[model samples]
Target: MSWADKPNGNDMARRAGASRSDFDGDFAALRQRGRHLIAEIVRLSRQLTDLQQAIGSRRGAPGRGSVSGGEPR
Candidate 1:
C-alpha cells in the first residue's frame, strides 16, 4: 500500500522533523496573538470615534473659528 493510504498520510512532514504537536502549538500561539490584536483594534476604534464626535461638536459650536476666517463661504 502507498504511504498516502493512512489517515495521517500528509503528516509525513512530522516524521521528517517537525511533529504534528509542534504545528498545533504554533497554531495556538498565533491564534492567541490574533485575538489580542483584534481586541486592541476594537479599543482604538472606539477611542477614534469618541475623538471625532468631540471634534464635530466643537466645530458645530457658534464661537469656534472656522478654517476660512470669520467670513461665510
Candidate 2:
C-alpha cells in the first residue's frame, strides 16, 4: 500500500469519533422507543383490568349475555 493510503492517528481518531457518535444516537433512539413501549404496555394493562372488572360485574347480572364458564365456546 502507498504511504498516503496508510491511516494516520488523526484519521483513525476521526473515524472513532464518528462511530461513537453514531452509536450514541442509535442508543438514544432505542431507549426512547423502549420507554414508549413500556408506556403502551401500562396503558393496555389498565384497560385490561377495567374490562375484567366490567365482565365480573356482568357475570352476576341477569340476561346480559354473560356465559356460564366465562369462556367462549
Candidate 3:
C-alpha cells in the first residue's frame, strides 16, 4: 500500500501507532537534524582543506627532507 494509505506505526519504534500529526512532527525534526549535520560537515571540510594547504606550503620549500638524508633509517 502507499505511504498515506498504509496503517500508522509499522513495525518501527517511532510513534508508529500515533496519528499523522505525530508522524509529521517526527519527520520535521529529523529533517532539521539532518540539515544541521550537513552544515557541520561542510564546515569541517573547509577546515580540513585549509589545514592541507598550510601543510603543503610548509613542505613545499627545499631542504625540508628527513634528517636521515635519503638513507634508510
lDDT tens digits, residue span 36-71, model 3: 989999999888767665555566624333332343
Work out the TM-score per prediction: 0.60, 0.58, 0.61
lDDT of 2 at 13: 67
Q: Give the top-scoring candidate (lDDT).
A: 2
From the highest lDDT down, the ranking of the candidates is: 2, 1, 3
Maximum-TM-score candidate: 3
lDDT of 1 by residue, 1-73 (tens): 5323534736676558877797787668668878998999999988876766665566674543334434343
Error (Å) of candidate 1 at residue 60 is: 2.1
Predicted candidate 2 versus true structure: per-residue lDDT over 1-73, tens digit per residue? 6334645636666666676676587568668878998999999988876766677576654333333446553
CA shift of 12, model 3, Å: 6.2
Off by over 4 Å in 3: 1-16, 61-73
What lDDT would each prediction earn against the true structure?
0.64, 0.65, 0.63
For every model in order, what is the number of clashing pairs? 0, 0, 1
Q: Tell me model 2's lDDT, rounded to 2 decimals.
A: 0.65
Question: Model 1: clashing residue pairs?
Answer: none
